[model samples]
Target: MDGQDEVSAREQHFHSQVRETTICFLLFAVLYVASYFIITRYKRKSDEHEDEDAVVNRISLFLSTFTLAVSAGAVLLLPLSIVSNEVLLSFPQSYYIQWLNGSLIHGLWNLASLFSNLCLFVLMPFAFFFLESEGFAGLKKILEDLDEQMYMITLEEEALQRRLNGLSPSVECDLLDLEQELQNVKTLKAKLERRRKASAWERNLVYPAVMVLLLFETAMSVLLVACNVLCLLVDETAMPQGSRGPGIGHASLSAFGFVGAALEIILIFYLMVSSVVGFYSLRFFGDFIPKKDDTTMTKIIGNCVSILVLSSALPVMSRTLGITRFDLLGDFGRFNWLGNFYIVLSYNLLFAIVTTLCLVRKFTSAVREELLKALGLRKLRLSSAPREPDSAKPSANGHQKAL
Candidate 1:
């Protein structure tokens, strides 16, 4: 009978774990589906005449805002569930009915808490960073378009110079016409510059949220770090192992959490500062040079490299190649690392590193040019040669005549 009871208890525990895991998975699915529908609506509602690029920017911005709200709210609600679990179990339950009632409430709280943390710390942060990156791409595209336009203007100017030197009777008129066209292009370029500046200013809307989240995360990380330090001090004092508050074992766990949080914070700051400065410099200079599009594929590739390096690749490589292996990874590779609490922290660190590296690479300029050659724009030298005859030069409207 004793053996049978033990077996039954084990079965019950296994079943309970399975149910909770399924519930958490389903909750995540539902949240993701909802976000999908929300983003789809924004895409469909965009105006028909709007530039495709503008519509894309709108969708990306909306997605990021929604992600930020959901992530912050979920993290904030984590404490409530934790409190319910600890406090509800201790309630006096002499009656079977009372015990069942408490158990149901506890279960519900756990489910809610689990869902919130998954959304907040994992899905939402990833989405937020992704959208921020899209914003950078949009700005970059605008700058490229500006460059192409300038190059075209330069080409027209060069052709006009050729006409003026060909001895054509219409050389004087061609010069006048080409100068007018160049002035018009310059005016349009000025308007584009203003638009770029406005877009940069609009990007500032995200700054407040970024700063707030950073501060909150920093506080949590500091608290955890302090806890881990206290634990280490207790261990060093050689007190009774059991009596040491947050014993060495628990302190080690705390230390792991601290490291994860600290890494996450560093990556986030790196992205925010780097992106802000990089984008600002691009806007300030108004340099128009063709650049490769840093599309979604590039971002994914960059993120994979970052995650591999920071999480597994570098650590494993060092261990295998070096003479010594340290406790650098903490408890990250263990089964407990998959626990809800552990995963929530782990995802943040992973996403931060990936997103930061990807954004930095996205903003890095690979090409530089002072003239827009692709758009037929090249620097021209003034020639004092005889003017072109009328039949060999362009018309007053800037259209070249048939030879």
Candidate 2:
């Protein structure tokens, strides 16, 4: 009788899971079509001179923004599904499985949270920094250069004037050259100043949401780190074992969801690497807003490497913290690392080694410059459009509505 009861329960569970999956698929399809229709309605014509690059950038932008618009909402809503960190980044199986897992909300939340973290912490700040300091050094540096030139020019002019006799031909020529150069520098400086004033609004456009999401991500990271530490310190006898089976939430992801998740990771990796390089070369922050369309393939290639590197990582870290349920991964979530070695490798050793190397290379001028050169080449491909176009306004408006 007990055997029959268990079998019956399993059947019921699977049935519900499939039903929920069906509904989710329908919902996704509806949303996808609606988004496409809306975007097409607002789509504007491109420039005559606009190359393949603009087409690619526009496509990439729309696809990514549409997905992230979904995720931004998910980060706000689906976090309510979280019950405990006892599971470490996931809710317990069987407890909230029907809602969070059957429909894949928990996984979405996890994925969304990661992306939200990157946007709030890295990209948002970097965007502000980019506007403040692009094209011809910066306002302060330009001012200093302009002042130095004027001072030198004045000194030369006065020295020539002080000559006991009327100025020599060479002295007069020298003063003329200095004055002309100073006038040129002043003109350039004035134009740069006007540019800064124009972009002042963007610099001040710091969204409050950035800080809120940053706090959330920081807290989550600290929790995971702390949970892993406890796992290390607490004897196995003291800590409770994980409940339910592997992949309680993971399940099999659809192609759409997979693409969305991959995009999430790619965005994170690109921003991280680019921000680091920009800081290194310009000794300041890097551009976060889509720079150029030419770099599409480059980002894809770099992100592929990042995916492989972090592929086995975050999941195993969740394992170390003893996640009682899987969240975002699909079929890939079926495998969980119960052993300690994988945990150390994923959570501890990877960061340690990478940090050490970064630190070493950071102080070494030659290696640091070389790293910048290689990264800069990739950055060069992404040469940003002079400025976002007026026609993009409708798309941006649509995104605002979606968000």
Candidate 3:
């Protein structure tokens, strides 16, 4: 009787997972397609000028597609694997068949996981490159050069002043040339000041975007873990009775869940700190009202916070609903909807973060060039007239006084 009940439960559990997976995949596919279309259209519009950043954007799109393809493949294969076990019992014996039947599903899952992990690694360095390439680093270099130029000019002025000491008043041309150079230096100094201000503005936007992307990646990691946990739980319940140790099954699931929860806690802290820092830094350095399309950083941070809140709420719901309990002999089931909820929330956060960083970095680079021009540092030239020889000979008394 118990065995019969267990079989019935397992069948039901399998069907439920199939349904949930189907729904989730459909939703993921829709979003993925929509995002692709939007990005493609944007690229087409921007491609006329052949902007240098176009290549970076394309790279991001490629990575996004790779991530989606691998993830979708894994999701699709999971249900097929389950169905195959029930439906295909007597295939011809072959090594390939055994490998496909036994190991392919696991391989697909690992492949999907690898793609998702690669997204993070790819995005971080990409963001850094975008920030640097957008002229943020160049601006800093220019400022340093300006400061050094100003110092050199000041040293020249001091030397010129000393040279003028005890000289007759006849060297008017030399004095005039020195004065002109001083005026030119002053003009250049003003220009450098303007460039510095512009650079600060650009940094304000790009830095926040980068920080938001990092938070988004962290949230995605949390979501991937949650999804894996859900899949694992379903697999466990669908397994035939006596196939695995009861204690080991429970211990493993619980450990995975605990680790995920711990990660959630750490991510929440990260989101909070990053958001606060980014928000204030932007306000301090840039315009408070970000341009419509340039508001990606704010949006990404907002998504991260929302996910953090949702993930934190799940443990409470799990404890309250008593959904954590599962019979080892019975089919897999999720009375705990918390895991699925967290997964969706985490994915959204990740998407928002990556998109925002990419956009902001590009926009800030454009703004930096404008600022440099406004500061008059764009191709400034300095020249001084030839110095005239001193006409008056120094008297013996004047020479003694100089000594």
Candidate 4:
């Protein structure tokens, strides 16, 4: 009777846990939907016409930016959901322990798991189907607008400065208004210049090397997600239970899931910092409009597609996937560190090869352009040179005009 009672209690406890997890999932799902709406409703158009002098408006804008950044950072939880009990973060001694101990990630794991599953099973394939929407049009428009406004502002500043200069030294009354105008013009010009710098590919965020790192980081995250998903999707009979370390519960994974999750959360924080510091960084995917015109955005979409291919698991699950289990719905025990390590190594190699190819492609194009420019310049110099008549051609060292 005691044994039966204990089993019944365990089952009840399990149901309770599931109940709470379901509630959290529903709550987060609602918030997730709301977040999109909130981001979309922000005052993007206000950027065009807001008075720079309005302290209140500026404060409101800052708050809005902060919210967007928070959402962007929240996306890091995606890895935690994907890596699950397998990663080091799930290690009891790991620092991420607090996450499951009444932390946000612990409370919201179900939602995150669902999100990660969708990203792996649904979005990855969709990205291949829609690799790109549009690109560079929005960027060109912003650059051209900045250039035009800057030129106008420069002319305005000069005109105002000239007006102030024309006034008599004793005419303090007229100088006051002109001085303020000039100051405002200068301020506006400075703002435009800053925007241009942020948008430039050569600037810090979008630099080629930085881009490669970002791509690799994202690739690793996707790989981890795939690993977790595979544990559920693959045939359970093959590996069987107890073939690895003692299985850990997902709830206990509050600490650290893996190295990748830890890195992702850190990256998310860094992303927030970068966004807040006046770089025209990526929005939290607030809108799709930029996909048509922004090269940076286009690259982001491309990165997703590339990562999906790198993280594919067809070799193991190709035949057994459907026959074995429905993914995102099985018991994938933790403690498979060796398998995880091997998988990580394999992904690293693949990512490295792809990165090298991309870098080489970039280098070759740059070198080709340089060579073309050099050849063109040489041709221009030669074609423009005067050809002396054959009879009057001078020797290399000594030549006088043969009149």
- The numbered model that scores best in lDDT is 3
Worst 10 residues of 2 by lDDT: 77-86
TM-score per candidate: 0.27, 0.33, 0.27, 0.33
How far in Å is the alpha carbon of 110 misplaced in model 3? 1.8
- Give per-residue CA lDDT, model 4, range 1-403, as digits (tens): 9999999999977876776677566655565466445433543432333233233333433333333333332343334444544543236567645334323334453344344445546654454334222123235546777999999999999888987887434568669878999999999999999889877635433454555565555455444445444553453432322223233333322233345345644544433333333222347433432232232323333333332232222212211211111122122222253234445345444644654565456557565444445334434435566776765866677785456
**Candidate 3 — what's its lDDT?**
0.45
Task: Give lDDT tens digits, candidate 1, residues 1-403.
Answer: 9999999999987876676566546655665566445434433232223365555544554444344334332322222222332333444343432323323334543444443345446644565455556665566566776898999999999888886888454778879989999999999999999998887654444443454455454454444334433433454332111122331212222124545433433433343344334443676433322123322422322322222223222222211211111221222223233223334334444544554564445434431122122222334534578777878777889898877
Question: Candidate 2: where is the Cα deviation over 4 Å?
Answer: 1-18, 26-195, 198-227, 237-291, 296-313, 318-337, 341-346, 349-403
- Lowest summed lDDT across 10 adjacent residues in model 3 is found at 323-332
Candidate 3 lDDT, 6-26, residue by residue in tens: 999999768755755665466
Please report, in order, the local distance difference test score of every candidate based on alpha carbons. 0.42, 0.44, 0.45, 0.43
CA displacement after TM-score superposition, residue 335 of candidate 1 (Å): 9.0
Ranking by lDDT: 3, 2, 4, 1
lDDT value for model 2: 0.44
Give the clash count for model 4. 19
Compute the lDDT of residue 205 as modeled in candidate 2: 41
Better of 1 and 2 by lDDT: 2
lDDT of 3 at 359: 46
Could you give candidate 2's per-residue lDDT for residues 1-403 as a string of tens digits? Answer: 9999999999988987786667556654565566445434433333112344344434444453344343334322312223222232334445544454434554444444555456445543443344334323334555766899999999998888877466556878889989999999999999999989866543334322333344344344344445545555655521222333344334322233434333333333333443334443552222222233233322322332233233323433333433222343332233445433445436544543454455455447664444445334435555566766665555644653332
Candidate 3 clash pair list: 10-331, 237-332
What is the Å distance of residue 88 in model 1 from its true position? 4.8
